[model samples]
Target: MTNNQPAPDGVLRLINGYWATGVIGAASAHSLFTHLENGADTAAKLAARAEISERGTQTLLDGLVGVGLVQLHEGRYRNGPEASAYLVEGKPASLTSFAQLKLKHMGGLVALPDVVRAGGPVTDPTTEVADNPHWEEVVPAIAAQSVPAATLAAEVLGLAGAGPISILDVGGGSGIYSAVWLEANPQARATQLDWAPINAIARRLLVERGVADRFTSVDGDFHTTDFGTAQYDVALYSHIAHQEGPENNIAVLARLRQALRPGGALVICDYVVDDDRGGPAFPLIFAAEMLLKSKQGGTWRRCDYHDWLLKAGFEDVSFHSAPPATLVVAR
Candidate 1:
């Protein structure tokens, strides 16, 4: 143990990463966290509660313990702090639906080889936007996932002081960004442009948050929508840029810039890679996910964004570090 040596830990973890993802998905699918929270500490009890065989329950519980999602004390199992907080059903920040969505994506990853061989996505990513039955679950799940980052983005953008702002949320999925800002700035109003299905969910979310009066939904594809000129004080593209190629992104940014008022801000919140397009592991790995999913979308570098924003007529561009992604703010 004292002797220093290179380890193959990284390689092994990479190879077996799917195992962890599968385990988490399975547990979330079965509401294991909820069962644990309800005091099903023994495998036999958990199995009874979950309607699964005792043997299978024990096996899954052991795997959860191994992954630190569950804790073992004596002969009892319990939800770990992370699981208790974010995986338990009915929790405000629960990510169970998000985990389920990931499970669906994991199933699609089997076609990655075909995508690579064909040099394109095997399935149309646009279909998800056109007729996604999962929107009811997905919108809320994504909003839950984005809450912290949205809060931070609002703070960083000084939404509180922006004063009677008119905002446009381009391709806003859950409308979480606008919702957060509106809550922070009572006088701020937002217009969310997205697909009809997603707009339905955004409407529900805004109504539920009791901010529907301050927000309006424009149901259409962002690529074709005429974002009316020079009216909005701020335009936001949260987690949308990675879904387009350079030319398309530039076009979209230019449209957004046109939508903003003179001296207005354009906020791009996405997973931005380094200039070399390597490292900062999330965006790099996310690029592979994009390859497997989108026809022409992947993470972009900060330089790429800077060039695009400048070309779109945005000045005084800056990048800020945000959890799970980077935030590029321009005016």
Candidate 2:
């Protein structure tokens, strides 16, 4: 009789997923795509430009080819379409800073086994770490990535027709979200609240975008900041909930609700999971990243958010499915 047991192909692939991550991370760290764009197509030229050994460059390039990030033809390497668009330095959509952020997280991710055994994170997730300079790069990189989503969000919220309004963007690093809204609605102004260092970045970005005249920066911890009662026409909590536990999120939501006008809306954008807390791979995997990096952060289910929003005095809470994330809007 023939054996009927299924092969563990998926499981094996999952186990080796880090191999792809490492290859991409290494390639990005070395600015390989930039080098390729600058005419270092051959491994010898790439190695010389990157200041790495020819053998190592060849091996890494082969791995990149295997992963579809690069293509090899006639003994020369070239970036694939996706890599060329998102990995090349100076490209409009370049994710170089995001790649660097991922590499920085490798330390905590590698210690995940110990963290799980100890039932907690082994590293401090607070911004106080002297060596944790990644945030400076990560904030702007993340903001750049959020531009499309922010544009979509502004459209969804109908901000263009909403007339003159005041927006409160909590934890708005780089103030990209507010800047997008202000751009879409000429009558709108925004106040962005974040830590001092991040606020500095937000200021610079807003100024660079020519929207600083309508933008205000509040530098402080959101948890203790006085948001001012009935101050904003809309309150935005973008990509923030997952970094907080339920209790903290609940408190934050209540505070934000109080800050909104009587008929204003609260907009939350994050990686939300299904009620059963299974599948939807991105959020589930991101939950692990949180556990490895934060003290009490993890992805929460949609139902959990519904309950919290309701309890926080929000009504008509609805979920919109956006690729790689979900948007929760409540009035």
Candidate 3:
């Protein structure tokens, strides 16, 4: 008896949606990826290593397998290739911060119903926190895992043939850029400026990466910092710029220009909106998250970045290949 009935859209969504969270949560709670850091193991072995009941662990492993996070061979379970690289703890690409940030902000998910009704975000993210206390812990975790983006941006800078580079990473978080660039080019140096909390993390990261000798960590409020006078060969406004209005962004770039040496470069990275201001989904989604959490929300558009850079006395501004965020570099 074949039931030839199409399920209602809402019903289908209700049944299948949110399933991904269960899989991720299971992995996080059990530290399964950390356990599997070295290699594959049977359900019993993994459960023993992770200190969970074998039956319970097997259930979660099966779920991960179903979600393509793990592979099942006989009774053994192992990380899938993607999971092994990014999800495994101790890996450079570990997504711990990504997962933790999602978990920390999961409460925003509750607004989905209202957002669906209103066709926009319901959260008011503009309320600023007086102090970012957890930044010390969070910054390091995020910076260590940011190699992919950093490497890509650095490559673009290299290809641009920019010379005598000195970068200022505002809200630089973990100083990954300094660590990576200094290692890549001995002639290059970087200043990682952020809040005191984040600088703590950045300092450790720089030291661990063996670049502390060259890299400088500046601690101050970016909104008020006097980023020096034409001292830098490059200025990097990464994930931090999108949090403010256009005026503020232009001001930051203007200040960056004042800080740049002659022919110095400026690089901007953020979730860019298309010129049409429609689609590409994620950046807009990020805007919504910013609305819900931060006071100022994220914004987009390649032209927007170029316009800001130009207004700031920059010429030959261009964008680099990047994720949802546009990477704008100028000199």
Candidate 4:
């Protein structure tokens, strides 16, 4: 909404945002979209398919309509374009797992006040980064979200139809980059570095993508692990910087710089805010997410990235726009 809209409605939407979250979560939990994609066009059919009452089903459908994810015509409901593409179960970009996983993470937001007062997570930040148990459940869901970001990065580098190359994916959660880049170039081989359990999930993902033979995993924390020197033609550190302080980020970037070959590229993807921090709503809100979860993480700016990349010995740096994330490529 524009800033000139009604003040009360804006405040209400901000405060009652959980209503939308709950509506989306509940709809996904019941497989409403998947059923709608089938023959369940009417409320009765949907309720029967979902094992819920027709009255409740209609209410849920109305909520979905209000949220712009569903459309109703002549008493028949249908999934919207986005719903059909990304919310249906088993699609390549389905976010069903990620949406449900968020239902669990929303509980953490309840303690935001305490977290803010403490200036970080009320729980130990140590448990939240490298070894978080929730990583297994959340990483797969996160993989779907990475599809466009990884694909865009690969396109930006013109990886498709290119010759043989090696990829080093640091904290490569769902192994989406490996799958995308390897598919783009059949001669390419990729290695992922992440926690053992998360790497297990990524391995399964790559296996499903039919590129398992060319994919490998390194099980360790990126903060302590040796990235090795002049090894990778391309390195990806997607969505990891927001969980780290500046020094930690620079240290990791330096390691990744050393890990790259002479002309190698390192891709850093995250929700990067503008230098002025004036607008771009999602990244601004993401800073709070970092605040609620990490000891020193927030959405960094382009200047910050440029400075860090230069300090890390990257001679060239550039930025690219990717929705829900941005790419900072350095060499």
Candidates in order, TM-scores: namely 0.88, 0.86, 0.85, 0.94
Using lDDT, rank the candidates from best to worst.
4, 1, 2, 3
Clashes of 2: 0
Q: Report the C-alpha lDDT of model 1 over 1-331, residue by residue, as the tens digit.
A: 2468768887887888887787788888888899999999999898999998889888888888988899999998999999998899887568887887776777777888899898788766665565878777667777777777678778877899988989999888888887788999999999999898898888888887888999999999888989999999989898888988999999999988988888888888899999997768888888887887788889999999999999988878998887568989999
Q: Give the per-residue lDDT of model 2 (tens digit) for 1-331.
A: 2498778876887788777777788888888889998889999999999998899888889888987889888887898998888889876457777876676666566788888887668766576342356568778877766766777788878999999999999999879888889988989999998887888888888888788899998888898989999999999999889988899999999999999999999999999999988868898888887777778888889998999999899988988877578889999
TM-score of 1: 0.88
Which scores higher on TM-score, 2 or 3? Answer: 2
Relative to the true structure, candidate 2 reaches a TM of 0.86
Full-model lDDT for every candidate: 0.86, 0.85, 0.74, 0.88
CA shift of 71, model 1, Å: 3.4
Query: Candidate 2 — which pairs collide?
Result: none
Which lDDT value does model 1 have at 151? 81
Model 4 lDDT per residue over 207-324, tens place: 9989999999999988999999999999999999998899999999999999999999999999998899875678989988988877899999889999999999999999999976
| Runs off by more than 4 Å, candidate 4 | 1-7, 126-133
lDDT tens digits, residue span 132-187, model 3:
57665456656645577677777887823554467788878778877777777767
lDDT of 1 at 175: 83
Off by over 4 Å in 2: 1-10, 35-57, 71-81, 122-134
Q: Go through the candidates in order and give the C-alpha RMSD of each one to the true structure.
A: 2.8, 3.0, 3.6, 2.5
- Comparing 1 with 3 on TM-score, the higher-scoring candidate is 1
| C-alpha lDDT of residue 295 in model 4 | 82
Evaluate residue 155 in candidate 4 and report its C-alpha lDDT on the 0 to 100 scale. Answer: 91
